[model samples]
Target: MKTEYDVIVVGAGSAGCAVAYRVARESNLEVLLLEAGSADKNMMMHVPMGFAFLLKPHKNNWSYQTELEPYLNNRVIDLPRGKVLGGCSSINGMVYIRGQKEDFDRWAAEGNKGWAYADVLPYFMRSQHNEAGADAYQGTGGPLWVSEIVDEFPIHQAFIDAAVQAGHSFNAQVNGATQAGVSWFPRTIKKGKRYSSAQAFLGAGRALSNLTVLTHAQVTQVQIEQGVAVAVQAEVKGQSILFSARQEIVLSGGAINTPQLLELSGVGQQARLRALGIQVHKDLPGVGENLQDHWNSYIKQKTQGVKTYYSEGRGLALLRNIARYLLGKKGFLGDSAATIGVFYKALPQASSPDAQIHFAPAASEYDAQGNLRPIDAITISACQLRPSSRGSVHINSVAADAKPSIRLNYLATELDQQVAVAAFKKARKILLQPALQGMLQAELAPGADVQTGEQILEYIKSTGEPVHHLAGTCKMGSDAMAVVDECLRVRGIQRLRIADASIMPSLVSGNTHAACVMIAEKCADFILRSSLIELVSPTRPFGR
Candidate 1:
């Protein structure tokens, strides 16, 4: 087997796939993409409704969990990271949300150049093949295929009406001119199957000879020689292997694994490494410091009349649904959870929308073990977009198999506490609206008895969980805590770059899959450009 390559892309997740494909197709750099998990061949990874299956602990799921958090009554939430070629995109809700323009502008304002809304919009557009077609804001042709919900249920429309009746406006496209109001979410599904990053980018470049993708290879650390990352040490089938990278070693292991890998490589806080009896390569405190996630809880309610996806894929219904999908490629299995989404300012004093609402026709709750408890119910879940609270992800042990310590520290900020109350009140107004009152039965959770602000706050804390949008552990910027520069190169380290959600200075206002893809797109462009510059001036190895 080949032991060396021009470039090594770690973790063949969303960003890794994009970078590998871009380098293989656009540049001649021999690329090796390594995934800790196996290939994206699991049938569940392709099914739109298969998220329910993938979300559970399985072979394709990393099945991570947080340390008992003292904030949420000492509850330990399930953290599922995709251990497959597509990574989280293969297992995510498939919601194609781009967050707000201000979210990116804030990044540029924080000294991260070329990341303003205007600068990053093209990358979003370039990665999209929206069913809505080409426009100023949306894209028509791209690797990732996005489409509007074709079989949106009647309850979804009524929920939108209820949102509008509750004082919010109806936006035809949330990814259009503005990010405010209620609209149908653009999903990462096409032709009745989930379109993950692996299928979108890697699938297209299968014919490329220079690109090699390795699965079931868990990278433990980067082999740094004289302060430069030249190779990666990995475990494949109980065998240790070293793969050399002539150019660079790109880390795209998302947030948790990326920082954990860095810390294991002795590239984190010096004191922490010294305490663990490991030699510190670089005392970069920011390697795993800034951890953040969007916190949310479902407001479950029972419906008296209309039928939600209460009993999907059970008994004869399963066979019928499969047959129906096979015949026409249209069914509930093809759609994503929730019908309509609302981006609104929960607090009037807030600058932009402070919360995002995801409303599904059916209701389900997670058990203490993080398993889904399905029911004949509807859910109006709201998430605080810009959380003031920040947590951290640190390695618990030096062993690569050991799970890292995660502290979400949700609702630690008073602003989030207030925002939770506002979101509940706003959702209450929508539920009580005459438009939805016909079919609405009762609020099952934090029901009619729980009315006061204190009660609502208690309800949110007890039931609230992360929407799986983890980021900022390996942040990018010029600050002292910034682990990587604007160009994504790890500070104080040569020939090493960290992409994926780990580099996000802050969590975007919406789902993170699309943003992760955009980051990879830009990273690939820069990699190719840097290679061209090096080719022009042989002595100039790095970017000029």
Candidate 2:
């Protein structure tokens, strides 16, 4: 293993993969990208329908769960984060969505310059090789491949048609000019296979020769020497090893792990670290604060007329699918879990679409121990897009591998509860549409008994699970609680930066992977700039 690199990117996740890719393509800097899990060579990971493969209690997943949410009648839910090369991108449903323009405009409005939708669109376009062809909104010869659904099932188109009937517009693309409509969700898949960020960046970046990727290497702490990140102590195959970075150590360990790493490295709240008997390097109280996630609940319906994923094609369906995948890469397995979507104002008084909706043709639910159980039905899950609730991630111990306390605190705010309740009402309306009514047999989940608003809220409290988009833990801003600056530099610490969903100042309007890719691409630009920021802190009086 190399002892030193020009840039050390800890966490070969959605952002870290992009960082290494951009850096290697732009500069000759020796970059080291590390991942805690093994390689992304698993065939199950490439199949779009195999999204739940790594999400299970597997080696490729972190398998973390949130504590009992006191506000939600005390329910602990599974939080599966990717540990492989592509990180969550590999395990996720492969939904390729850039949040609404207002999400970025809001960030720029909050003093994060160069983060407006207009400013960041080019980076998104630069990273995308959309199958829809190059246009003002998309690019052609980019790394990440974004395409429409491979096998567009009748249920998908039926759902979209049903949404249009329910007083919504039929949008060809949700990632286009507007985000408030029913549309066919774009996916990070190409040729019927899942194309994660690692496939787009690291897979292509290996040819650059300067970029090095190390799998199964878990970083424990960033060695802060005199308030400057000099190296990192990591565990590799039961051996603790230190790797030095000459320029910076970029933490892309997502929302939960990034903050945990910072605190483990003695760079969080002094009070917490002191109690854990660890020396404090920086007293950044917001290291794990401001945690947020989208609260989504499944509303399923038993359908009779529709042919769902559960139906087998007479005999040898599994064998035929495997053969088809190996030969032409076209089959049911190529289908994304969520091929249809809707964005609308759930609450009567809400402006724009405050809720995001997903339509799954196949009915599936997490069984005990968190395994996906397929059912012969259809499901429409809803999540309030911009929830006002906030939660936290913190550590009370120093063990690097020990799971930290994560509290999503779902529906902690009145607005969130109100919007969520309204969202379910809208979901019921769409399910009763004439198109879906033909296929629908009965309400399977939170069934006909759940009608009243109070009963719906109770049902939500009983069945709501996260869409698994956790973000904003180590927020970026100029506030006292800001863990990172506008440039993503860690507050009061030099030669360190965070480039992941964790650094988002606020939750984006939709799925976070696309936003995360854009963030990492921007981080590469900041690092490559000839003139860096010059900040003077207590320990670094000389310069930044």
Candidate 3:
């Protein structure tokens, strides 16, 4: 491996892949993209419906469980992050949601300049090649292929109809003019295969002479020299190696690892760093603060006459589906996990959709041995689009390989609790609609006995799971707790920036993969533009 490069981007996940790709292509900068996990060469990773097998504690997945959450009856929740090239995008359901426009506006409102809906739309467009064609909201001619699910099931349409019958409008394109109502979800798939960030961006940049992509390289810490990030120390195949960055060092290690890396590098709370016996470099209290994730509560029902994934995903049917997918890239295997989506307001007083429902024509449960077993049921999982509850992630040890303490205080706030309950009730209402009622045999989870709001809240506390749309640990804003500025440059650290979900001032209203790509697009633009300016400046020293 090379000892130096123009730029070193840590964590070859969703944002890291994009940033490295853009920087290498847009500029002549030599870029080093480092991933702590193995290559994305797994056969299942390419299959659209293969994410289910990758969700557990697999080699490609960093299945980190949260510290016992106090708000959720002290239960530890599984927090699976992708340890592969594409990061979570590889293991995710492939749902391509950019979130509500107001989500970005809220960031601008929180003093994060140049992050409004209008300001960031171009970046989203630039990173996406929506196969449905381009319009005011959608974009074409990009690396990331965003298209509708290839194989649409009857149950998906039935769920959509049921949601509409439940008073929600039918929106064909949720990422278009407005993000509201029931709609078919767009996915990051191409030619009936999972098109992860690695496939979208890194695939195009891998052959570039200026770009060096390394797998199984775990970054330990950023070496700050005179308050400027100069290099990163990483363990590559169990060998300690240091790579110096000439221009910039970007951290794209998602919400969890980015903050953990910062804290380990002594860029977090002074007291915490000192307590860990680490020399403080930059005392930024927000390094691991403001952690947020969507908490999902599901309402599952037994299916009577419908053929869900439960039936088709096992036995002879499974073999047939696999053959069909291999032959023509068609069948149940070519579909995303959740095909139908409902973005609606759970609270009547809220403007726009404050909650989201993901309808899957399948249900499964983890056995005592942690094996996933499909059940004869369909599920409609609901989550507060904009959760008010805030949680945190912090390093419990100075060791780089040690897992960090993740406290996802789900339903900690009154508003979050109310929204969770309201969304759950709304999902149940949709499931009970005439269109779905004809197919559903009975409510399997949170049955008729759990009807009252209090009962629903209790059920949620017991069953709520993280949707894995984790963000906001390294927030971007003008506030004191903001770890990055609007340009994504890390506060109190020169020549360092973060381009990942961690920089989100707050969680976006939906799945975060699209938003993370957009952030990386903008981050690359900023780096390239700054380099151009510095190159032409008379007073600036060249190659300092």
Candidate 4:
């Protein structure tokens, strides 16, 4: 069997699949993609509403738990990342959104060359097959499909109407024209099935002879020789196997694992490695710093006779959902729990946007089991966009199998707390409006008498949680603090790159699946361009 290939793409998640698909189809490169979990052949992964099952520490998900957060009063947060072939894309909310143009422009402003909105627009354009057809802002022919929700629920329309009454304008396409107001979100779904990045790219390209995808292969380290990445060491079926990369080793292990993989390969801080008893190969200080994620706070209300998703008994609901989904892909299962979203500037004339609101029609609470607790309720989740605070992820032990320590530092920044308070207050006002007053029966959370700003703030701090948009551990920039350069090459390593959500300089305003896909599209071009350059340049290294 051939042990070496042109590129060894690790973590067959959203980004890794994109990298493999592009390399195999666009170039003569032989791409070997490895995943830590089994194929996304799970029946749940295909069902639009099967996310509930996939939300747990399933075969396709790594049920990661965060270090106790000080702001949440030492509560441990469950961080569920996909371990399957499509990674999180196979298990995410599936809402598609290109982040605000300002977010990308800020990357350029922060010294990340070629990452400005104008420069990266092509990559975003190239990734989508928007149902809205060709426009200056949206693409027509692309690998992934983006469609408008065909069945807009009543609650969704009510939320949009309320936002409009509160001075927010209606936007037909937030990913088009401008990302300045409220709109129905586009999703990475086509024909009512989740169009995971793996399905769009890797699955479609499986017919190609040059691409090979291995599942249940957990990569432990990148094999480096004389400061150059040459292969990867992984545990396959409880036995270690080494697969060589004739040309390059790409780390698409994401924010948490990408840095961990680099550190295990002796490519991180010397003192930390020494403490762990691992021989250090490279003393890179920025491998796992700069972790960032969005935090969510909810406003819940109950409606009498309005029919919440929480009313149905578990067995009956499951059976009905299954039967409906089986007979026709249309039903409650086809809906994103939070199908209606509004991105707005909480404070008019503010320097940057403060809040993002997601209106979920379901009357349920996500408990520790990732199951919806039975109850009659719909929730408005308000998130602080572009948090001013930042956190870090680092190794806790020298053991390669140990989980990395994650400190979210959520709500640590005053601006973040302020935004949370404001957004929660605003949601209350919207609920009280005449448009929604008749539909809402009563305030089910934080109650009506909790009027003071301080009271609302306290409520938010006690109940806030993560939206599952983690990024920036191996940030890309031109600073000494950056783990990778603009082209995504590791600072001190050759023929190695990290192309995943980990490389995002900052988190996007919406769900990150679409943004991660765009990152892969851009990195594919960068890799292809560099490979062509090496093919002709005199500096191309000869086989040793």
Q: Please report the candidate that would top lDDT against the real structure.
A: 3
Tens-digit lDDT string for candidate 1 (1-544): 7889998999888788987887677666899999999988888778787787788898899988888888789999889999999999999989999989999999999999999998889888877898878888888667889988985367877888889999899998898778999998889898989999999988888998989999989999898878999999999888899999988889999999999999999899999888877778889999888888988866888887775777554678768878888788787888886667899999999899889999888777668765677787788889899888888998878889998989888888899899988987887778988888878887898689988999889888898878999999999999899999988999999989987999999999999998998898888777776764334233221211
Supply the global lDDT for candidate 3.
0.89
Which 10 consecutive positions of candidate 1 have the poorest summed lDDT? Answer: 535-544
Local accuracy of candidate 3 as per-residue lDDT tens digits, 349-442 = 9988999988888888888767567889988899998888888999989999999998978889999999998888888888778887678887
Error of 1 at 185 (Å): 0.5
lDDT of 2 at 54: 65
Against the true structure, whose TM-score is highest? Answer: 3
Candidate 1: lDDT of 48?
86
Model 4: lowest-lDDT 10 consecutive positions: 535-544
Clashes of each: 1, 0, 0, 1
Which stretches of model 3 miss by more than 4 angstroms?
Answer: 533-544
List clashing residue pairs in candidate 1.
Answer: 363-377
**Candidate 4: stretches off by over 4 Å:** 307-322, 366-370, 532-544
What is the per-residue lDDT of model 2 for residues 237-295, given as tens digits with 9 covering 90 to 100? 88899999888889999999999999999989999999999899999989999999999
| Cα lDDT computed for each candidate against the true fold | 0.86, 0.86, 0.89, 0.80
Looking at model 3, residue 509 earns an lDDT score of 90
